[model samples]
Target: MTTTVPRTANSADTRGWSRWAAALILPIGPAAVAVLRYVLPYDTVDDSATMVSKVVAAPGRMSLVLWLGFIAVLTLVPAAYSVGRVTRQRAPRLTMVALLLLIPGYLSLGWLTAEDQFLWSGAKAGMDAGAITRLADAMHPSAAVAGVFFVLGHVLGTILLGIALWRTRVVARWAALAVIVSQPIHFIAAVIIANHPLDLFGWGLQAVGFAAVGWAILKLPNDKWA
Candidate 1:
């Protein structure tokens, strides 16, 4: 009689490795944001003219920083989904809600990048700062709507995800709490006060929280990860 080998073991091993890869990717978004905040030249208070001037002065550096922000936003989608997946066991409803909001919120970041590109291109073309600022200031209604979605979705969704993580008790309490408060601190720093240091701290908190969760995920056995 010929012996047959089962494929189940190999399939499971593949899935387990995928989970490990995801866990490794989870903290990258927040860490990139932290680094971007540290290196970014303009604050929220800086007008388009000021921003364009900065970009003109250091086009290569500004391009790299903008690309970093773009990468951070893109990676955050998977990171958010992973958080929802891990937390679903204990807080299914909360995870569902958070993902619904967070996914779109993260996606909306692509729209916001258009303005940055416009600024960069204008500077590259040797357009006057005041002219660039004027054009940049003229926002369409759709852009405004997307901006609102990005703000509300990321802020509220992250907080809800933090709550879900807390309920699960998968990660440390401090990690969950850091996730909960990071976004509000970011809003206050970026919008209200326009403080670069505070923005750095906010992103730092997010990085710490995600890093802790990533560590916890790494420790989980393959059977438990799903």
Candidate 2:
């Protein structure tokens, strides 16, 4: 007779952890980004919130805040990825890669945000950097490029994630619906914001993406199911 070891029915652990993580991730990432912009801006980075004019005004202070936002974006990546994985559809490898890519793209986008904030701050400081140059000529076209990349990542990865969610039976159907709705909104916002890096609404849309992911994670059955 062979004795077989069965998988533990401890999905509770993963569920608890994910729920808490979702809660923390929800606040940490976006809030940190918000703080950096307000507290760090030496020039009141309102108008040109995406330029060197701001950075030049208060190098250390503003840079710290900008970089902190950068970090917050990075921190959100894993939580989002975990939500996708919990879905258990298919192509986790690809999903994982996309998740990893999101982190840097997120940072780049924040860097772009920092630039926008910086410019606005510069304007307030009365530094007079002149008319906003063509956004194309700015630092890296990442403000535009990364936005598209983020959409692609969500589209491709989420398709697989939807499948996985269907398979794992972890997340509720409500979560699936929320996750699905989030991508298209993000895509449209990305397209609109590509040329206008200073727009905070689009950033709020991306934040919506995070909030939905957190809800989905809360809905999951946890890893013990595997």
Candidate 3:
């Protein structure tokens, strides 16, 4: 097969950097969000609100510009690079799903923060009074719905991602295989308790899928530069 047809159109490529970024993305992203979240205020959001506001605080507004901007840049550049490289590998379906979830999921900030960004129960919950007042002025009812979609996208996407990680050639393949087998089993458990107080455990299953993908990309073999 011609290099352009599949392997790589340009061995003289930046794919290495792209994969490296993907590997680091999971760990760095949350930390970055945590920092951004810190800058927003926690009061004023009511216990009865149904949406997250983009301007819950100035820091949140700025962080969205920074982190969401980062997300957009990464998606256009690294994600594009990862497309054929990761997707055409031995296991493609799951990897592709993972990527799809990750890229758009970042935008789901609206969904994830709804509980407090616009509806903080108290100052101890999220940001300060000024931020909450700002958010309330701009908050909308759709933010919660947006958040739900975001979480669902991530949750459903994990099944495919877990499969892809299990296929990475990093640790002989047996370890990957073990993870692959275990994910589906655990996934069932998560789905079973998807309601009531047990839903929290379901999240744990999802986190595994997150970690596995991170490891796969981190361990992904990039011989384009070697």
lDDT of every predicted structure (CA atoms)? 0.83, 0.51, 0.45
Model 1 over residues 106-214: C-alpha lDDT tens digits?
8887887677778778888998888888888886777778888888998999999999989999799999999999889989988898887888888789878987887
Per-residue lDDT for 125-202 in model 2, tens only?
Answer: 656455433432455665667666655654555444544454554555554554445445444433443322232333
Error of 1 at 224 (Å): 1.7
In terms of lDDT, the poorest run of 10 residues in model 2 is: 193-202
Give candidate 3 regions above 4 Å deviation: 1-12, 30-88, 110-139, 167-221, 224-226
Model 3, C-alpha of 33: deviation from truth (Å)? 6.9
Model 3, 1-226: lDDT tens digits are: 6565556656657767866766555434333333333333322232323223333333445445355435433432343224325444666666666667755655565455544433434333666656655555565767766655555554454445445655555333443444344334433433443231222233333333334445666665676323
Candidate 1 stretches with Cα past 4 Å from truth are 1-4
Better of 2 and 3 by lDDT: 2
Best by lDDT: 1
The prediction achieving the highest TM-score against the true structure is: 1
Q: Is candidate 1 or candidate 2 better by TM-score?
A: 1
The C-alpha local distance difference test score for the whole of candidate 3 amounts to 0.45
